[model samples]
Target: MRITLERSNLLKSLNHVHRVVERRNTIPILSNVLLKAEGNDLEMKATDLDLEITEKTASMVEQAGATTVPAHLLYEIVRKLADGAEVSLATATDGQTISVASGKSKFSLQCLPQEDFPDLTAGSFSHAFKLKASDLKMLIDRTQFAISTEETRYYLNGIYFHAMAEGKALKLRAVATDGHRLARAEIDAPSGCENMPGVIIPRKTVGELQKLLDDPEVIVAVEVSDAKIRFTIGSVVITSKLIDGTFPDYQRVIPANNDREMRIDCADFTKAVDRVSTVSSERGRAVKLSLAEGQLTLTVNNPDSGSATDELAVGYDSEPMDIGFNAKYLLDITGQLTGDEAVFLFADAGSPTLVRDTDSENALYVLMPMRV
Candidate 1:
């Protein structure tokens, strides 16, 4: 393929698609990106068997053709070119190499036959919907941190998405859990999502989707089937395989009857937890939280190291109680809170604690306590 495009445009499109290609691949063609030049655009595609990303950028096509080249290598070459420079890519007649020329720098990269690249065939989709970029980003940001990394329970490795009716309104909910903590976030259900099947998006796909949702003004089109999910964001398209395992009923784990309520500033609590956890041992990062009438004290003790203690005035009127939690988990939940004040509902020292932002009704968190 022969094409000429502005460096900025090519770099932007390559940045989106090259990330799908794995650093190492057993199949030779899987390591290269498929480049097709036709019409007034150059389409770039990369895949790692399970996930695929495709992006198109406006270009001046000199000859209609297609080829595959090292994804990261091409991206690096375009990235190093001077800003505003025009880049020219031409496939040699022998079909063995692709020449990249920009200003005074030129490089030739080995090419693979475009026919050898594998295609992830997305069978007919069962459901399709459009969501605002801001709403989609919010759902991902709030729950992605709790996705389990354990390989045994592969079902919990991705955020669970489904549509549910709450009171009189329908809501689209996203839930993620790592056995010790859970994060749930929801938004008003967009049209065409009420009867969609519940799907577990893989962790890597969630991360890549999050990065693509940087523009708040764009509208994202999502298509889902039983085995695969596809996201079309502007000129970029990402298709990924959904987890095959079933997600557990997360509603059973969310505490709904915790009576003791403690309202504290989210920022202050996060800082206090971070400060106290500094002295905690790496194996056990437990931080003890003691609450009384109107005071909350955070303490971390490690026999191998020193101890730390921090106190903050909170809006608590319940009986005194002490609970231990992983300091890192606490910080993760608190960091996602958007409001200044956070409410924590406690059932007991051993039971799960419920946390919610005082100003946001769309998200909630449940934390399993750690014994001190």
Candidate 2:
């Protein structure tokens, strides 16, 4: 295919789709991106069997054709080219090599036949809805950190998306957990999603979707089926296979009867936890929190390293209680809270502790305690 594309335009489209191409692939074609030029646009597509991304950009078309080339190599070449320079791509008559030219630089790259590229066939979707980019981003950012990385319990390796009744209204909820900690966030359910089926969006898909939601003004169209989910924004489309495992009933793990409450400055609490954990061992990284009538003390002790202790004045009026937790987990959950104060509800040192942002009612976190 012969086409001319602005360096910036080509680079932007490449950056979006090239990430789906694997660095090493058993099939040669899977390592390349399919490029098709027609009319006034050039389309780029890349896939790694489980996920696929396609994007289109305006280009000057000289000849209508298509070919496949190494995705990373092409991206690098376009990235290093002079800024604002126009890049021209023309395939050889033999259809085996593509000549790339920009200003004073020129190179030829070997290519595969376009027919060899596999097609990503996403079946009909049962549910389709539109949501603001900012809302979708909030749902992902609040819960993505808690997704489990363990391969054994595959169900926990992604974010569970479903519709649930919140008081008199139905809300869309995202929940993620790794056994030690769980994060839950919800947004008002969009129209036409009342009958949507629950789906487990894989971790990779969640990451890629985050990149697409960077523009706050953009509206994203989401389509879901039993086996796959698709997201479309403007001329870009991303399709991914949903994990087949069933997610456990997360409600059972959330503490229901915790009555003791404490509230502290979110930033101050995070900094204190970070400083005390410095002395903790790499494997354990546990920090002990002792809460009393009007004071909270954080301490960490390691056999090889010295101990660290810090105290903060908090609003705790219940009986004195002591709890141990992973310092990293505490920091991660605290980082997601946007308000100034973080509220914590505790039952005892042995039960799970519920945490929330005092100003936000839509998000909550549950962290299991560890023995100090």
Candidate 3:
């Protein structure tokens, strides 16, 4: 292919598509990105077998053709070119190498036949819908951190998305869990999402989708089937395979009645936990919470190191009790809360505790207690 485009335009498209290519590939063609120049645009595509990304940008086409070249190599070359500079790409007569030029810099990249690039076939989609970027971002940001990393529970390695009928309205819900903790978020379902089948989106695809949703005002078109999901955002498109397994029923773990309540300043409680955990052992970073009539004390005791304690006044009038929790897990849930005040509901020291944000009604978190 022979094409010339502004360096800024090429770099922007490369940055979006090259991330899908793996650094090491058992198949030689999987390491390259397919580039096609036709009419007034150049289309670039990259894939890692499970996920694929494509983007298109305006360019000047001298000779219409297609070829494949190392994805990271080409991205790096374009990124280093001078700003506002023009880049030219042309294939040799033997079709074995492609020449790249911009300003006084020039380089040659090995090329593979474009026909060798594999295609991820997206069959007929059962459901299609449009969601505002802001709504989609909120659902993902709240639940992504709780997704399980263990491979044995393959189903829990993704976010489960489904539409449920709540009273008179249909709500689109997202849930994620790692056995020890759970996060759930929801929003009003869009018009086209009625009766859509539940799907588990892989963690890698969720991460890429989050990055692409930087523009809150943009509308994203999503199409999904039992096996694959596709998202179209502006000039970029991402298609990925869904995890093939059954996610356990998460509702069973959420506590129905936890009467003991404690309300505290989110910022103050987070700082206290961090301070007391300094003396905790590396293997068990547990911070014990001692709740009294109107005060709370955070303490950490380690036989090898030392003991630390921090106190804070809380809005708790429940019976006195002590509970232990992992300091890191506590911080993670608090970080996602948008409200100034956090409410925690406890049944006892042995049962799960439910946490909620005073400002947000659509998101909730459940954290399991740890032995101190």
Candidate 4:
């Protein structure tokens, strides 16, 4: 393939697809990116068996052809080139080496046959819908942090995406949990999405999708089937296989009868938890929250290190109660809040506590308490 592309444009496209190529691959072709030049655009594709990303960019095509080259090497070469420099890529007649030249620098990279690259087929999608980039990004950012990293309970390793009817209105929801904490976020369901099948979007796919949603003005096309899901934004397409596990009924885990209520500044609560947890042991960084009328105190005690305590004025009128929770978990849930204050509903020191942003009715968090 012979094509000339500006350094900035080429680097942007490379940065999008090269991340899908793994550094070490059992199959040599899997480590390379497939490049095709035709018409006025150059197409780049990279995959790691389970996930695939393809992107196209406008370029000057001198001779239309296709070849495969090391993804990381090409990315690095183009990245180090001077801004606005023109990069030319041409394959030798033997089709085994590709010459890359820019400015006064030139290098030849070994190439693999394009036919050796495996194609990730996304079967027919049963449901397709469009979502605003900002909405999709908010759903993921709110719940992805709670996805389980544990390999055994594979079902919790992704966000459960589905559509549910809330009264007469339908809502699209994403829920994630790691047994200790759970996060749920929902948005008004877009047209034609009410019948979409529930799917567990793997963690990696969620991360890659977030990158594509950086442009708030972009609208993403989402397609889903029983075994796979695809997302297309502008000229970029990402296809990923859904996890083959059933997500637990998350609705049952959210407590609906929690009585004790407390409202406090989200930022203040986060900072207090962070400071008190400094003296906590690494293994169990638990902070105790003592709530009483008009006052809340956070304290952490560690046998190996020391103890810390902090107090904050909050709006709590219920009877005095003390609850222990992981400091990190509290910070994570509170960090996602976009509003100034957070409301907490407590059942008891032994039961799960429900947390929510006072200004947002579409997102909720549940944290199981730990014994202090």
What lDDT does the true structure give each of the candidates? 0.95, 0.95, 0.94, 0.94
lDDT, model 4, position 77: 91
Model 2 misplacement above 4 A:
none
Candidate 3's residue-wise lDDT over 233-315, tens digit each?
A: 99999999999988889898899899999999999999989888888888989999999999999999999999999999999
lDDT of 2: 0.95
Which tens-of-lDDT digit does each residue in 1-372 have in candidate 4?
799999899999999999988898889999999999999999999999889999999999999999999999999999999998999999999999999999899999999999998888646988999988999999999999999999999999999999999999999999999999999999999987868889999998998998888899899999899999899999999999999999999999899999999999888888889889988887998999999899999999999988999999999999999999999999999999989999999999999999999888999999999999
Give TM-scores for every candidate, taking all chains together and pairing residue i with residue i.
Answer: 0.99, 0.98, 0.98, 0.99
**Weakest ten-residue segment in model 3 by summed lDDT:** 118-127
Distance from true location, Cα of 336 in model 1, Å? 0.3
**RMSD after CA superposition, every candidate:** 0.8, 0.9, 1.1, 0.9
Candidate 4: stretches off by over 4 Å: none
lDDT of 1 by residue, 12-39 (tens): 9999999988998888898899999999
Winner on TM-score between 1 and 3 is 1
Per-residue accuracy of model 2 over 101-218 as CA lDDT, tens digit each: 9999999999999999988754799999999988889999999999999999999999999989878999999999999999999999998688899999999999998888889878
Candidate 2 pairs with clashing backbones: none
Tell how far residue 339 is off in model 2, in angstroms: 0.2
C-alpha-based local distance difference test score of model 3: 0.94
lDDT for 159 (candidate 3): 99
